[model samples]
Structures are given as structure tokens and as C-alpha cells.
Target: MQVDADSFLSGSSRRWVAHYRKNLDRDWQIPWSSGTALTSGEKQRIAASIAEFQRGEASEAQDYLGKSSAFSTVARDPDFHAASILFVAEENAHAALLLRFMQETAIATRQHSFSDVVFRWLRSIGDLGWSSRVLLIAELIAQDYYPCLRAATNHAALHRICDKIEYDEKAHVRFQTERIARLEAGRSDPAVGLRRGLQSVLLCGAIVVVYLEHRPVLRARLSFGKFATTVLRRNRRAQRAINANRRCM
Candidate 1:
């Protein structure tokens, strides 16, 4: 699901649909039989770290999908709705994969988490722009988070699961970024600036909360500073691309 810049920037939901359909074909064939290698302490630590994220990923997005009709004018991509459906399905697939890994490792699933609740609320606000922006933050965080999750484990199944999820998340980021840029294409400069400012604040807040919640997993690969810097850097690049897309429109 690692889309190229040209394809991702093309703003063609047809391409997105094709990409998602093709992505669904990847089995990963995770070796569920490769029993976990984690110790009792490791299981407890990772379960606490990953449960919230798994819950967040599983958060239903029926509202977001329904609200996507608002994108008809701004997006105008004939296949946009189909792509959106596929995208949501892909996310749910990630949740299921995580759940399987968790069951294998004796990690319990979370019914709720504070951050997940807040993020779910943000996406339920009946505004496509806000929803896309909020989702983008989660997707960007996953770029770094999944690798850390993989590194934190020696379990083969977990590694493969992380690899699959990380791949899909990259495409999800691109998909959301494209939509956000398109949605803001004709907005006033000050309006765009204001929203971007708010998005920055939101991103920063989410990073702090996530780092606090999953520092053990993240510390496997990135220090706090490194993690923050990486996510911020990606956000800047995404913002620039958004601006670029707006200009072209």
C-alpha cells in the first residue's frame, strides 16, 4: 500500500480504489503458530501499550463514511465514495489483525481509552475537514508508532502484523491529506492558516498523550525527542503538500 507521490498526488479516487482493492489481496499470512516469545513482564507492558491503539483503530467510522457525501463537491472524484469504503475496511482489517496478535500474546482488548474517546469525538463532529484532519494525526503517528511496536517485540507474528499495518497507514495518510487539501482548496488564506494552526496544536497534543501512554513501546526505537521530531517533520511535509494541492486547484 505504499503509494508513490505521483499516484497519491493525482487526486484520483479511481486510483485509490484500485490501490485499496489490490491491497486487500495481501495476506501477510502471519504465522499465528509462532507462539509469542515475550516474558510475563513484556506481555504486561506491551498489552498496556497496544490495547488503547487497537481500540482506537477499531473505533467505528460509520459517521465519517456517511459524512463523506459532503466531499462530493470538493472532491468530485467519481470513485471517492468507493475509495472511502475501502479505506474504512482497510482500517478495520488492521484492527482485526491486531486483535488476533493480541489474543495470541494473551493481551487483553481495551473497551475504551481517554485519547481514543477524544479522537472519536473529534471525528464525529459532522465536519469532513475536521474529521480528515483528526484522522491524519493518527495516521501520521502510526508511521512511527508501528515500527516501534515491531521493534519492541521478538515475536514473528507481531512483527508481520506491524509491517502490514505500517504499510496501510502510509497510504491512509496520503488519502486523508489529499482529501483535506481538496476540501480546503478554495478557502481564504486566513481560514486555511487558522485551520492549519489548530491542526498543529491538535497534533502536538496527541503526540504528548500518545508518548506518555506508550513510551515503553516507543522507547524501543525512538527517544521522545526523536519521535516528536519525526512526526512533526512529516506533518510539515504534509502541510506543504496540502498547500501545493490547493495552489494547483
Candidate 2:
């Protein structure tokens, strides 16, 4: 029998719904609330990054929901549904927060087309299974990308946002880790293993592409080579950690 939504809305689902409602209702006080000074270029860079992050997050949410729908019969897990809802809601909240921040600061931002970049990256990672893609992307965001963002941002408000984002991202990494473990425990297909390997490669490649594209901006505002090197090193370290943890289990 297909699990009814109402029936599944127990245990974790109930707790998650409560958490989501609280998050939706709570007034998020902007840290670094002062209207601090910033250069036009700095503001532009911040705006662009925020826009890109939101776009990427939306893509992730759509992909997750699509995959979850397909796997629901096999998975039959309410926790998965609840987690997906939480992920989507969080991404939406992030987009809203960024929009509000830009509006409040009076920052004018022109949307630059990054579709080509996104499509090419996705195509390269297309061989990977969805579960692997999730882990690879989460690890990249949590360990490599966010640190670069944190290091590059000088504005107090921006840093505060990034700090909060980084914390959330770390939790996302844990979520991915647990999900992957559950998948591996239940499914042992060689195809799935190969897909995961391909995903890791593609994820690393995408990180390089992002670093290169932002190199000029990063160089001027922050230490260019230093930031890139730190991110790459962190990426490697995170991958190793994930692998080691998996092996121990």
C-alpha cells in the first residue's frame, strides 16, 4: 500500500513540521545590523554571489523532490519526505533573506547569465546517481565553498550571514552523510558505486570552474590564490574524511 501522507505525518514528520513552522514564524534579526560602509564593487559581488547561491539551491530542491517522488515506493520513509521539505523551505528562506538584504542596502544588481556554467557542470555530473550527487555537492558547499566565501567577505553583515550559512551547511553535510550510509546499506549495486565515483570527479571539476570564474573578483577583494588554495585543500580534506568515515562503518 502506498503510504498516505496523513499516516506518514507522525514521528519525524511531526517534529519537522513543528520546526519548519517555527522557522517560518520567527523574526530573523539581522546580525551586523548597522548600515556599514561598502564599496560599489563589493556590494555588486555580494549581490551576484547571493543570486547565484539562491539559483543553485533552487535547482537542488527541485532535483530532490523529483527524485524523492520516484523513490518513495522503494524508500517508504517519512523522514525522507520531511527532510526534503525542510531542505526546500530552507533554500527558499535563504533566497528571501538575500533579497531582503539587497533591498535594505539599496544595492543595484544586474543578473548575469550563469546558465551555461550551470548546464555544463550538470552535464558533466550527469553520470552520477542522485544520492552521490547530493553528497558531492553538499561536501563541496560545506567544506570548500563556504570557507572561501567567509574568508572573502569583509563586511560585518555579510560575514554574519555567511557564518550562519556555514553552520547550516555543516548540518547539511551530516544529513548527506547519513543518507548515503542508509542508501549504501540497503543498495549495493555496482552501477551505483560507479556513479558515485563519477560524481566526486565532476564535483571537484565544478569547484575548480567556480574558483576560476571568481578569481579576479576574489583577488581584488580577498587574497585570490590564497582563497582558491584554501578551498581546494579543504575539498581534499573533506573528501578524505568522508571516505575514512565510510570505511570505518
Candidate 3:
């Protein structure tokens, strides 16, 4: 289920709205009763990683609401504003799901992480376009990160939760990538190229930071090179999607 802009962002957001609405009714039936028995090393590694990710998820979309009106106006998609609201709700849902897992597993959540702080700062300083690029970068990282997290722990509940999060994240990246393409469509080639270049640099730095930060869980399934390659590949696909949309326009 590769999510490109055309299939996702056709004039009306009815499909997008319906998609999120459908997900809201989903029942994951995570086995909360199944206790998570982790090795000391696993616990030590995953606790901070989950906490940081949970915090990051919770903090996202706060500013997105404020900027979405401008997005609707610029993109000329009336439903985009409504769709953006649903997007924010879905993000908050992911945060809640992670928090539930953390609570059941006795993993304490964190207040702040260095990566989260920096990412937040980047989001804060930018307009919707820049902020969305940052958000998409995080989603690309999560595309890999969640799979490693599912494999790192033996907990069925965590696996289920990760599956749900991963599922939603794929759609999120697609939605965001399309939205970004529309936003960048009217910009000069050099401007879009420069932003893409900046995204590449940010993506590289983010990969290194996240890999080190969650090395234990990530190492369970991927080496640094493999992880970096996977995320970079996803980023490239998104870049291609944006470019393709621009060409069509």
C-alpha cells in the first residue's frame, strides 16, 4: 500500500477524512494482561526510547492546528482544514496508545528528549512547509523505528500497538508528502530544491541521533548502515512523489 499524492490528495479530503474516521473505530484488542518480561538490557534500552517517542508523539500537532487555516487557503482545499484536525487527533491517538503500553509495562514516560526538543524547535521556526518536512522526516524514521520496536520486545501487546502505529504512520507520511508537494508546487525550482537539500541534511542528522538514542532496540533488527539506508530510501521515495506532482502541475 504505497501512498502517493494523487491517490491520497485528490481535490476533496473525503477519502482522507473517511480513512481517519474508520481508524477511530478500530479495536486493536492489545493483550494488556500479558505481562511484558524483558531482559534488563532490553528494559534499560527500550524504556527511554519508548518514553522519548511517546513524548514526541504527544507534542506533535499542537502548532499544526494554528497553521492549518493558512494551509487550507493556500492549497485551496476547503476540507483540508477539517482533515488537518483529524490528522492531529490521530497523532494524539498514537501518543495515547504508546502511553498505555508504557503504563502497562511499567516504563515511565519522559518529559523531554534532546531530539524532540530540537525537532520541536525546527517545527516552531518554520512555516507549514518547513514544519511538515520535519514532521515527515520523523514519520520516515518511525517507519523503521516502529518495526524494530515490535521486534525488540517479546510483548504481544507492544507488538500490536506498534503495528497499529506503523499502519497509521504510513498514511500520515503519504498525506503529508502530498500536502507538501501542493505547497511547494508554486515555489521556484531553486526554492523547492534548496528545501529538499535541507531536508536531506536534517534527515541524515536525525538518523544518526535516533539510531544512537535507540540503538538497543534498533540493533535488534538493523545495523546502523541498514537503518540509515532504509530511512533514506523512504525519504527518496517521498521526494520523488513531490517531484512527480510538481511535473504534473
1-249 per-residue lDDT for model 1 (tens digits): 325433554456788889999998888988888765777767866888788888878855888887775565444545777888888888898889889778877788888788888888877874787789989999999999999999987889889989999999988888888788767766799998998999999999999999998999999999999999999999998888888777755
Residue-by-residue lDDT tens digits, candidate 2, 107-177: 54445447444643563443223544544464454454555555555666666666666666665555555
- Per-candidate TM equals 0.92, 0.69, 0.91
Predictions in order: lDDT: 0.84, 0.54, 0.85
Native-referenced Cα lDDT, model 1: 0.84
TM-score of 2: 0.69
| Comparing 2 and 3 on lDDT, the stronger one | 3
* Model 3 vs truth, CA RMSD: 3.8
Candidate 3 residue runs with Cα over 4 Å from true position: 1-12, 74-76
Backbone clashes in model 3, listed as residue pairs: none
For model 3, state the Cα shift of residue 246 in Å. 2.1
Show where candidate 2 strays beyond 4 Å.
1-28, 44-47, 108-112, 115-135, 150-153, 186-193, 220-249
Candidate 1, backbone clash total: 0
Error of 2 at 202 (Å): 0.9
